[model samples]
Target chain A: GAGVSQSPSNKVTEKGKDVELRCDPISGHTALYWYRQSLGQGLEFLIYFQGNSAPDKSGLPSDRFSAERTGGSVSTLTIQRTQQEDSAVYLCASSRPGSNEKLFFGSGTQLSVL
Target chain B: SQQGEEDPQALSIQEGENATMNCSYKTSINNLQWYRQNSGRGLVHLILIRSNEREKHSGRLRVTLDTSKKSSSLLITASRAADTASYFCATDVRRDKIIFGKGTRLHILP
Candidate 1:
């Protein structure tokens, strides 16, 4: 892929509905990241996957939020029983190991929980 | 939670003027990067300054890093309306865990 790709660019789900957002990182990029951001606000780290290592989950806000990255290429962020607070843009970024925070970002998924 | 804190949460300037934003982090960093986001989505990498480097420049953008203070600043010279966007500063803690600040919302008035 030329750049990171995110699916269902915009989504509106009723409160309590479960929704899944997907991300396909650049080819051969071994690192993938998920972040949550309110409109015009800073990014909130959600989770990160680096190669085959156990993902760093310290940033998950609650039990309702979970994510998985399979095959080290595509990653999914799942929000269960979504609440209105879950409404925000979910961004995905990828970088190679030791890139020193040089991240390539996707456009993002705007998830609106009504 | 975000480790970096950007100052002047929002800034507005007329076109042709300059815009400066600062970011402060709490820990040792491998490097610091600045990114821009338009319409609140899609981040465009602007520049990165390694811990050992003090300053770097790219086009109209100038970045300065001070490891002693754990701070960095981005200066956009001769700003334009196209520069209107949210500017973010990010730092890497380890292999690939890059943490970001909320960002400074910059609006260039035409």
Candidate 2:
């Protein structure tokens, strides 16, 4: 793809249900990131992947949240037990190696846990 | 935790006036970049300043970085209605990942 692509654009789920958001990064980009933004709030770092390196999960809010990058092209973020507080817009971004400063972002998936 | 803190949570100014937002970070960084978000969607990268650079300009945007103070400022010249959006500053804290601030919401009064 010419730019980062995210799936579903919007997802509405009941509390305690699980949800999965997907992201397709720009081709050949070696770095991908996931961020969460609550209503009228700053973005919260969730996870990061650089090449084949072990993902940096220091930012994941809880064990319920997990992500995987398959074949270094697509990524998925799964929230095991959704809570109302989990409602937020999940963003995905990618950048070329050594160009982490310049990121290309996807439109994001707006998750609403009711 | 957020690596940067943007000043003035929100600002309202006339369309032709210039708007300036400041960001302060706590640790050494590889670089600092600014982005714009509209309607709470994805953000668009505006400019980036490496730790070694002090100032950079792009079109009507000017960015300044002060490593000693661990701060950066973004100035939008001749702001337009289209510039009414949220501005964020992101820092590469460890050269591995980027973290963004709470952002400054800019509203241009027509």
Candidate 3:
């Protein structure tokens, strides 16, 4: 793809339901990131993947939030037993090898937990 | 937790005027980057400044970073209506992950 892509632009789920969000990063990019943004809030780092190595999941908010990157390209973020506080826009980004490389972001999935 | 915070949560200005947004971060960083978002969608990278460097310019955008003060600023010269968007500052602190600020909403009135 020309840029990072996220599926199911919008999702509405009830409390205690489990939801999964997907992301497809740009071809050949070695770095991928997931971020969460609530209404009128800053982007919160969730996870990061560099190639197929172990992911950096330091930012995952709780045990209910988990993610995986398959084949070093597409990624999935799963939230278990969703809570109203879990409602937010989940963003995905990809970048080249270097640390200062520019990041290409996806449109993001807006999850609303009722 | 957020690594940076942008001042002036919202600003409105005439189209031809310059728009400036400031960001301050905690802890050290390898590089600082500026991004723009329109209509609450994805973000677009604008400019980046390395920790070793003080300033960088791209077209009408100028970015400056001060490591000692742990702060950065984005300046858009002769802004246009198209430049109306929320500007964010992200810091690459070490190799962990990029931390973003709450962002400053810019409204350029035509």
Candidate 4:
């Protein structure tokens, strides 16, 4: 793809339901990241992936949140037993190695747990 | 906790005026990057300043880094209506990951 791509631009799920968000990073990019943003708030880092390995998962809020990247191309973020507090926009970004810190972002998935 | 923190949660300025946003980080960083988000969507990378470098420029955008103070600033010269967006600063504290701050909402008055 020309840029990072995320699926289901918007999602509305009930509390206790499970939700899966997806991210497709640009071709040949070696690094990927996941972030969450609540209404009018700053971004909260959730995870980072180099190739297919996630070296930093310290940012995941709880055990209910987990993510995995496969084939070094697409990634999935799964939230189990979602709560109202899970409502937020999940953003994904990818960067090429040696690009310093330049990141290309996807539009993001807006998840609303009611 | 976020490694970087942006100041001035919100700012409104007239078009053609210069707008500046500042970011402060808690630890040493390899580099600092500035991004712009429109309508709360995905962000676009604007500029980056390496820790060893003090300043950099990209067209109308100017970025400065102060490792001694652990701070950075983004300046948009002759801002335009289209320049209205939220600006974010991200720090590459760890070589493998980057953390972002809340961001500053910049509104350009027509």
State TM-scores per candidate: 0.96, 0.98, 0.96, 0.98
Which parts of model 2 have CA positions greater than 4 angstroms off? none
Query: What does the i-RMS of model 4 come to?
Result: 1.1
Give fnat, all candidates.
Answer: 0.85, 0.79, 0.60, 0.70
Instruction: Give the winner by lDDT.
Output: 2
Off by over 4 Å in 3: none
Q: Count the backbone clashes (under 3 Å) in each candidate.
A: 1, 0, 0, 1
Model 4 clash tally? Answer: 1
Alpha-carbon lDDT, every model? 0.90, 0.94, 0.90, 0.93
CAPRI-style docking class of model 1 based on DockQ: high
Q: RMSD, model 4, all Cα superposed? A: 0.9
Q: Report, for candidate 1, the interface RMSD.
A: 1.2
Clashing pairs in 2: none
Candidate 4 CAPRI category: medium
State the local distance difference test value for candidate 2: 0.94
Q: After superposition, how far is residue A6 of candidate 4 from its true place, in Å?
A: 0.5
lDDT at position A24, candidate 2: 96
Model 2 chain B is weakest, by summed lDDT over 10 consecutive residues, at: B90-99
Per-residue C-alpha lDDT of model 3 across residues A1-114, encoded as one tens digit per residue: 788999999999999999999999999887899999998778999988888664578899999999888898898999999999999999999888765458899999999999
Worst 10 residues of 4 chain A by lDDT: A95-104
Better of 2 and 3 by TM-score: 2
